[model samples]
Target: MIPSWQRSSQGVPRAEDEIASLKTQLSSISDLQSTRIGEAVAAARDEMAHGLAGRVSMVAELLTEIGGKPENSMLNLAEIQANLEFIGLLRGPEPPDLPTEIEALCERRRLIYDARDVFGDLFDRVREVLEIPEVSVTVVGTVVHDDEVDDETDEEL
Candidate 1:
C-alpha cells in the first residue's frame, strides 16, 4: 500500500492536486498556442497584401496630386482604378477584398497542418509533463464536501 498522504478518501490516487496544477499549465499553454494560430493568420494576410502593392502606389499618387481640385482629379483616378480592378479581376494584381488566389495560397499553407497531427503534437507536449506516478491519497474521515446548500433541518439530533 502507498503512504497515507498519497491516498484519497475513496482509496484512489490523490488526483485533485495534480489536476489543479495541470489545469494551470494547460490554460497558459493553450493561450500561447492560440496566439500562435492568430500570428499565422496575420502572416497569411501580409502575404496577401503583396498583391495590393500596386494599388497602394496608385492611391498614394492620387492623394499626393496637387494640380487640380481634390474631388475631380482624385475621384477620377479612383473611379478608373476601381473599374480597372473590377474588369481585371481574373487578370492582374489583386484588390483588397476578393482574395481568390490568396485564399488558395493560405489554404495550402494551412493544409500542411492537419488537424489530427496538430492535436497529436499538442497532446504529446502535454503528456511530456503529465506525471502520473503511483499517486496515493489518504482518505479523510469526514465526508463533508463543499456544496452550496442549506441544512435547515430543525429536527436534527
Candidate 2:
C-alpha cells in the first residue's frame, strides 16, 4: 500500500481530497472578507456623502448671510442667493451628528482591514503547509481621510 503522502499509480495522493477541502474553506473565507470590507467601505462612503450634504447646506446658509455685504460691491449677491436656493434642495430633513458618524465609520473600516490582513496572512501560511499554491490576496478600498475632510471644508470657505 502506498503511503498516504505518496501519489497513487494514478499520480494523485489521497491528500488531494483534503487539499481540495481546504481550498474550499479558504475560498469561502476570502469571499467573506471581501464582502465585509466592501460593506465597511460602502458604509463609510454613505456616511461621508450624508455629512457633506449637510455641510454644504450649512455653508450655503453662511454664505447667504455673508454674501449680503461683499467687500467687493461688484460681487453679485443674487448669485449667492441662487446658490443658497440650490443647496436648500439638498439639506437633510433632520441633521445628523455627521462628524462623529464619519469618524466612527472610518475607525470601523480601519479595524476591519487590519483584521482581514492578519487572517489572510494566516490563511496563506496554512495553504503553504498543505503544499497548495499560495492564493494571491488583494485588498481593495479607499483610505478614509478623516482629517482632510475637515481641512477641505475649512479651505472651501
Candidate 3:
C-alpha cells in the first residue's frame, strides 16, 4: 500500500498536481515549438525573397525591348520607366501598418501575461493566508477494445 502523501483519498496518485506539472512542461515545449516554427517561417520567407531577385530587371528589359520596336518607337520608355519607379517609390518599402499591428499585439500579449501573473499571485496569497488544505484528486479513464475484426471485403459487402 502506498503512503497517504503519495496517493489521494481514492488510493490513486494525486491527479491535480500531476496535471498542473504536465501543463507547465507542455507549455514550455509548446513555446519552444512556436519559436522554432516562427524561425522556419522567417527562413522560408528569406529564401523566397532571394529566389525572386532579377525578376524586376527582367520586366524592365522586356518593357525596354518592347519600346525599342520600330512600330512602338513613339512609346516613351523613359516616361514608362519613370512611372514604374515612381509607383515603386510610392509604396515606400515595407508596409506601415504591419509594425504597428505587431506592436499592438505584443502589448496585448504582455497585458494578458501580466494579468495571469497577478491572478496567480493573488491565488497563492489567499491560499497561504487561509491555510487551506489542498484537495487531492485522481483522474480515471477507460478504454474500450473491439475483439471482433472484419476484413475490408466483408465491410464492403
Q: List residue ranges in candidate 3 displaced over 4 A.
A: 1-14, 58-67, 70-157
Q: TM-score per candidate, in order? A: 0.29, 0.37, 0.32
Clashing residue pairs in candidate 3 (N, C-alpha, C atoms within 3 angstroms): none
Candidate 1 Cα outliers beyond 4 Å, as residue runs? 1-13, 54-157
Task: Give the per-residue lDDT of model 3 (tens digit) for 1-157.
Answer: 6678988777777877789899999999999999999999999999877655544455455445434332322224434654575466559876446566557546655665665565555555545544556564443344444423444556878
| Best first by TM-score, ranked | 2, 3, 1
lDDT of 1 by residue, 23-125 (tens): 9999999999999999999999888786567555654554444223433444456557556755677565755456764575456445434533554454444
User: Which candidate should be chosen as best, given TM-score against the real structure?
Assistant: 2
lDDT of 2 by residue, 30-101 (tens): 999999999999999999998878766665654554454233232234346445644654485766565765
Please count the clashing residue pairs in each candidate, in the order shown: 6, 0, 0
Model 2 / residue 124 / CA error / Å: 54
**Reference-based TM-score, model 1:** 0.29
Candidate 2 versus the native: TM-score?
0.37
What are the lDDT figures for the candidates, one per model?
Answer: 0.58, 0.62, 0.60
Candidate 1 lDDT trough over 10 residues, lowest sum: 127-136
Per-residue lDDT value at 125 in model 1: 42
Model 1 residue 31 distance off true place after TM-score fit, in angstroms = 0.2
Candidate 2 regions with alpha-carbon error over 4 angstroms: 1-14, 70-157
